[model samples]
Target: MSEINLTIDGRQVKAEPGMTVLEVARREGIDIPTLCHHEKLEAFGGCRLCMVEVESRGRTSYAVSCLYPVAPDIAVRTRSEKVDKIRKLLVEELMAHAPDAPELVTLAREYGADRNRFAREASFCVLCGLCVRYCDEVKKKNAVSFFDNGAVRQIKFVPEVAKNECWNCQECFAICPTSYAQAAYLLTEALAFPGQHQSVKRATKAAARKRVVIPIAPVPMTA
Candidate 1:
């Protein structure tokens, strides 16, 4: 594999072409915060917690290091006043959604973010997509997925299919950043009703359509 040189937080570093800025920074002992990134799973840059300042080709911008690819002549700043500001804001948003999430709680303390800053209705899921991606990519199952888009989006599960096709796999529940009670309730309903669920048809149609739900990657901030 060919190598490329870049500077992360003033430290010169060499990384492979496909290596993401987060991976390179980690390899170089530079810390970048993340919520949806898993070593065993594909890159899912939902959380903007890992935003880093990057300067490449005369343009200086902030990028989510987990999905941002390293290139030659690139310069990265993991911790700066601007970067810290963005990260703190991102953490604050996450706190409002998943106030009880252990990882998120710790991150909030680290960044000196207030949990009640943006607190509203308690939304357990922060839309990190970890459980959804894990079910689709690793387990090769479609038990749960995000329904709709934007602020109205939610995790939809097929009760019948989950009972049969899902085989009671709670892998996603275990890794979920929020409480698993909601998911558990759905599973219970599946077992009790057997074939009664609203999302069954939707699941079938989704499977047939095989719609490719692309993971959201952060774009670099424009100069």
Candidate 2:
């Protein structure tokens, strides 16, 4: 594996030939903010939070560092004022859609996003596709996917069937970048209440009673 020399934040750094800009920056102790870029999964480039200005041969352009491979003589600026402003706006927009997501709200605060200037909408998924990618690429379940068009698209689990394709693996719940799936489940549990499963509750009480018998012959056996 050949190495490539690059300049990041005016500091010289070297990385392997095929390393992404994010990888190189982390190695060099340069912080490049990211949201949808997990180390275990392939870069999906949906959040656009890791955008950085790259210069090569006098050509400068913004690129998502998570997807841009490092190259020799490449120059990268990760924390320019321009990059900060754009990231703040992107965080605000994402928050407006999912206001209840605490992770998104915290990220917005970190980027200095003081206000969400966009209108709110009813949406659970941030469209990061962490769930879909994990299920298909890592878990090999293929039990869920994204569907629909335009503003209506979302991640959906496979239709219920005899095989129980979902397997209740909760991969999507674990991989959700926004924590929306877990929050939704918490809300559902709150709404469903304890009385929803009356039969199960009765059976549990009966089983507890059967396990609590007072053995009359226990003292004789001990003697």
Candidate 3:
């Protein structure tokens, strides 16, 4: 593969041809925040958090770094005043719907976003499409999809059945970048088991996996 020279954050860097701007930045130790992006997954560029100002030849504009391939003589600014402002606004908007999401909240705080002016709305899904993409592109399940349109749109597991059409493999839940899977598991246990309890100690110990020491309140003896 041929090497391409580019300047990221004003530092000269060399990256292989076809390397995305995000890759080049990371190789140079420049941190460009991203959501809806994982090293294990393909670049979707759905989240605009990694937007950077790219100047190539005579033209200059903002591009999603994760999707923009690096070329020779490319000048990329990972963080500019305009980019920071836009990222802050995006984070603020995402937070209004998912205020309790720690990852989202952290990113928002990093960008100095203290408030979400948008009215509160109920939405658990971030619409990253990781689930759908993983299913269709990676796993080839294609059992679930995003249905409806506009504000009513959501990650629909199955159109006909209310329950998930998932293969019971838990890939969708596992692949979700947000803590949706953990939250769902907690809710499911609370509702399904009610007073009955199960311990992760048994599962972890039996499997010889890393011990997950979760606190469990002592059960009072029945009178």
Candidate 4:
């Protein structure tokens, strides 16, 4: 790919074509926090935490760095008064959903976000889609997906696939920013397949029974 030139945080940088502004900034050691953007998955832009100020044609505007491609001669500001203020607001909003997430708490401290700025929502999911996208794109296992929409939207595991696949692969758990994906799956398993654990235990016992040979002590005793 051809090299593209862009200015990020007042520093001239060169990036490859098709690279997003966040990629360039990260390459140059510019720290732009992100929630949904993962290197292995497509940009969902679900979380606006990475919003940055972009200057093109002498006009400034906001853009999600992960979704915004780096264009030639474009100037990007990873942080500014407005960008910080916006990020702080975004952090507050996300904190309402996952108030105890370590990453969110860290960002809240950095941005001076008020955890209780918004009413408490114990859903504990920021809807970053990292789990869903990672499971689909990287693992090629469409076990988990988003359900519903708008305010009540949630992520759920497909019962059939999740029962067989999720136990073998919890890769999505690693990518979740709020760490709620595993909890969500466990809750689903409990609700959808109440006997799943019992079934596994029975299977294990049956397997053990097959190996249980009561010892060949009779042959020695006869001798």
Tens-digit per-residue lDDT, 30-88, candidate 4: 99999888887888888989999999999999999989998989999988999999999
lDDT of 2 at 211: 28
lDDT, each prediction: 0.72, 0.68, 0.66, 0.79
lDDT tens readout by residue for model 3, 32-122: 9887777767898887889999998889899999999998898998888988998998888776656556677788778988655777654
Least accurate stretch of 10 residues (summed lDDT) in model 4? 214-223
State which candidate has the highest TM-score. 4
Given candidate 2, what's the lDDT at residue 185? Answer: 33
Task: For residue 146, give model 3's deviation from the true position in Å.
Answer: 1.3
Candidate 3: the clashing residue pairs are: none
Per-residue alpha-carbon lDDT of model 1 for 46-88, expressed as tens digits?
9888899999999999898888999998999998999888888
Model 1, residue 112: C-alpha shift (Å): 1.0
Order the candidates by TM-score, highest first.
4, 1, 2, 3
Give me candidate 4's TM-score against the actual structure.
Answer: 0.85
Global local distance difference test of model 3: 0.66
Q: Tell me model 1's lDDT, rounded to 2 decimals.
A: 0.72
> Which window of 10 residues has the lowest lDDT sum in candidate 2?
214-223
Q: Superposing all C-alpha atoms, what RMSD in Å does each candidate have to the true structure?
A: 10.6, 13.1, 9.5, 12.3
> Local error of candidate 4 at 51, Å?
0.5
Misplaced by over 4 Å in model 4 are 149-151, 195-223
Between candidates 1 and 2, the one scoring higher on lDDT is 1
